[model samples]
Target chain A: MISIPIGEWFDALINWLKDTFPAFFGAVGTVIDWCISLFETVLSWPHPWVMILVFTGLAWAACGLKKYGLALFSLVGFSLIMGMGLWSHTMHTLALVLASTLLALLIGIPVGIYAGRSEMGERIVRPILDFMQTMPAFVYLIPAVMLFSLGKVPGAIATVIFAMPPCVRLTTLGLRQVPHDVLEASDAFGATPLQQLVKVQLPMALPSILAGVNQTIMLALSMVVIAAMIGAGGLGGQVLRGITQLRIDIGFEGGIAIVILAMYLDRVTHALGSRSARKQ
Target chain B: MSDDQTVIEARGLYKIFGSRVAEAREMVDAGHSRAEILKKTGATTAVVNSSFRIAKRETFVIMGLSGSGKSTLLRLLNRLIEPTYGEILIDGEDISQLGPSALREIRRRKYSMVFQNFGLLPHRDVTENVGFGLEIHNVDESTRRKKSLEAIQVVGLEGYENSPVQSLSGGMQQRVGLARALATDPEILLMDEAFSALDPLIRTQMQDELIELQSRLHKTVVFITHDLDEALKLGDRIVIMKDGIIDQIDTPEGILTNPATEYVATFVENVDRSKVLTAGSVMHRTPALATHKDGPHQAVRTMQHEDLSSLFVVNQNREYVGLVRIDDAIAESKKGGRSLDPILQRDVPTVALSTSLRDMIPLAGSTALPIPVLKEDGVLAGIVTRAALLSALSKESGET
Candidate 1:
């Protein structure tokens, strides 16, 4: 007969989160946000063709041939549709996705490395992640409301939480799964523990870590809808508005847009991950 | 040997598992069998009071079965696992007593290990994998890159620098591992069953590569293997371990010819003694009573070089007659000047055309030199030794 008090439980949950997460990322996030604002300003220049060319080239470099071609077509089509709708919401969503995923990687990878190296860190953090992953999407919207209180920041926060798990889990798993023999060999080769982790373990674990990044991106995309609850306007907000106002056509179109974006991100990130694996 | 000359020295090495290792050792010393002691005290000893020294630049092999602690012994050399009780001195310094940082510095600068699994980093291409150890020492990126490229060439993987390790075959991956070790150019190389995972042909190739590398690099190596043939082929001196104890430590020739104990003898018995036993081993050294020796032909040349030859015939004044052929030596030595092989006395026999004369054996009732007759089998089987013949017959009898 164990009766747990709700207030005590809530306090425990907060304490658990504080203990689990890395403190460095909070500082890193501020700098990253400023950088994102600068990048957005530059991207907003009137000549759209130059930006399109650069993005296409980046896609070509990362994914190569067939995927790059498909991505190019999708980008052109998306631009045409946005032109017809006469809205900049699509561009805003694109910026949000890019900023959030980059931030997720920056925060997730180092924390993953720490968790991988320390058993205690892994034990402390893993259960909290399990809770984060399983919790309803709307639950995060409340914290987004309380803290950032609606807009792009709330959307980004929701995306970060949702997309973060894979990066952490994959990084930890990849580092942990590095062969015992390799570690022994590094030790015998006169490599210090730090050297072994940076040179031996991390490099070997890259493919898997990249896979985690891809998963994190997908999870972050799922949270795009949840972010709309906090009035973050994107395709997800369009869909939410369509549902609330009972406009079937608008909702259906927004759903299609979401699908297109998800597919593009998945292919690009997956290709990037495997490309690194092959280079290694 | 003095401390300076001894590259590796272990004293009172005791690797005891489980909490009550001390109590277990005490019980075992007080007249308990290892099994009884283990049951009573819940401890297992992997290295039991072992001690040895390896000279610099020597190829020292530790040979043992799967559970005999050969790998454990090798691991202890680099302090991968701390010994329950021991001192491991590398170049006169006790490595076992060093701190983690100092131990790491020693590992970075002094030694490198190769594993059977070819533990190349999967995420790194050949050059990157090779450069990893150098990178750890905070070497400049460009220097590490150039050195790693050089190491890749050394292991014959020049074109594979950008190839992922997983894309390579087992043999190629093994080369990457070797290159990774070589990149650091450390003082010692510890190989623990480095070729055991490969196919037989690849194993042989890797062994040859090692021999060639050792000749060039002259790096001190501690090679571990379960295969006696590999041990014989490679070891400058072999340490044969059995059940956590060193059974014998000797040159391959010494171990095969004069095994130290019954355990070692069991291993030596099944081995092809002819291949391992050198010409100097069975050769009978004698005062030169025979003079005026027949012009040394290849037939006589072969007998003269080998230890277990038929006989050396001579005149009363101790002058040499054409050497007595292997089989008819007793009869020919007594009869005086009756040319044994009219053909052999006429011409020198080249060992190159015939397979190793050392490989052949004489059959009972056959003329001693076992004149290798070309066959209805239409092939010329090289001459066999008396030792080979006896061993074959003995094997047959034992089987029956």
Candidate 2:
């Protein structure tokens, strides 16, 4: 039988990449760490009640003037998290999710636009997105730890990889769905390619793009919890601790906290997506 | 926009779509059929050696059925679809040789287009959609607003300017599209099936409004349509296309009276001729006209001698006044009236010389006396009796 030693080759390649790009990887890690800490500081600066009030206001506004149910749900959900004494851990998990989602969008949107504009770009980027999405979430942690070492930074990086595919795929889909006659009209009226994108394509594609953003936030929240196993601190760490010690009480508390946070984020972003689908 | 000067011209244009354009061009030049050329060279020839010049203020229409390359030819004028091998001259500048920025300058300042489906931005209100071209030109916001408002009023959509385009009816949306094109005051207005999507009633109303607007604006217009009637109504000159080739180009009346080919003959063969032929074309000279100087005795004698039941009354200069029937003339003569004025029927129907025979059919049918055809100056030009109208209808009646 023909034997292919893929594992051995991958390890050799990783070792070489680490040796040759020590400064490069360190720089990337510093940037990511800075982003996470920045959010973490802002999140922790205000008192918990003040933060709760802010979230409540955002929920109310996102659901529009008449819809206050989401705001009430947010208020009750955050107060319960505080009552459980898991406030700081929830904040930490939030910082990671926000930073990862921000970074993913920054990179994914431009790639999505390029892929959407050209067939060759889509063909090249599609299979890679498929591979990133389908690979088990736990499989990349070993190499992540080997490369960046155990910290919030590696966890955030892994979270970024896990959550980026939807952002790209949906951006491409949104742009592709623009009517051919609309594009042709823009061209006929002397709009440049850049102008067409900004004035017409982007506006038309916004709802789909917002849907992608909602999906990314949900995926990032899930991946951050999984990142807890690699010494990343948060409610994820508390859940990991409960699992190792066979403490159902601790596990359920951390699980409930994650659920509340996920639901709040999902509702806020979902409201945003649907409201932008049409204009006044 | 100088008179008699060509504003747009195309020379030896050819558009063959596929990889081997050179081979396709060769086959097209060698007179191969489109399908044969496509099979041999994997190319479809969209326009083949087409050329024409549009004069200033001319409503030039390119007309054909679907897949006849009428739309493609319109696109070629603005270089929206580049000609495979040709030079397009606009005001003596060859657009084919101009660089991208130069070409954009021409498009931005001098050319605007209206699309078939309106091609409106659904997210924008009517005013914003109308101002789209001005915004592209980087016009000041105040000026853009003022210009767009003017265009909106021109298209008779004044109150709907602030409404979202999606909320408007299809006809209103199309008006917004037209306003968008006119907002820029471009020298050339390229309309590609602009009114084809509207239902028939709205389409006819729009066509009439366009005719009114054209008389006032006099912009050089290149219009495309598949409907023969629309072409006849709007086009100062019509170019008929078949299989990516120009079959004939002529005035509508010229084409209707004498078709250049069997294909063009078939196109005009089914037309309702009453809609095209004017009263002037069918009217005969007034055989027995009575002048006011002639008394009822003279009028009655002329009518008796001419063997007619009715006689048209005219003044000394031969300007039409009214009609005097034989019975009224006899009664006036019996009463010893001095002139035919007392007995003249002043409320009789009179038609303008330019009114189409279709619109005059009912008037002709309802009146027993001849309908006087008067020129724009009210001079008595001719008269259309029922017999003449029927004869006119019968002579030009084709398939229908």
| Candidate 2 to truth, TM | 0.88
| Worst lDDT 10-window in candidate 1 chain A | A80-89
All candidates: DockQ: 0.53, 0.45
lDDT of each: 0.74, 0.90
Q: After superposition, how far is residue B245 of candidate 1 from its true place, in Å?
A: 2.5
* Native-to-model Cα distance after best TM-score fit, residue A251 in candidate 2, in Å: 1.6
Off by over 4 Å in 2: B1-3, B280-353, B362-392
Residue range B288-347, candidate 1, lDDT tens digits = 222233433433444655654543344444433333444444445455534444322312
Docking quality tier of model 2: acceptable
Provide the TM-score, chain A, model 1. 0.83
Candidate 2 colliding pairs: none
Please write out the lDDT profile of model 1 over residues A1-280, one tens digit for every residue. 9987986776676556545653643444456557556655665554455555655566677787756675576567556545546235555566677788888898889889989989999998899889878987777776555454457676787788878888999999999999888887777776767778877888879899989988987877778776877776777788898899999988877777777667767777787998887676
Error of 1 at B29 (Å): 4.6
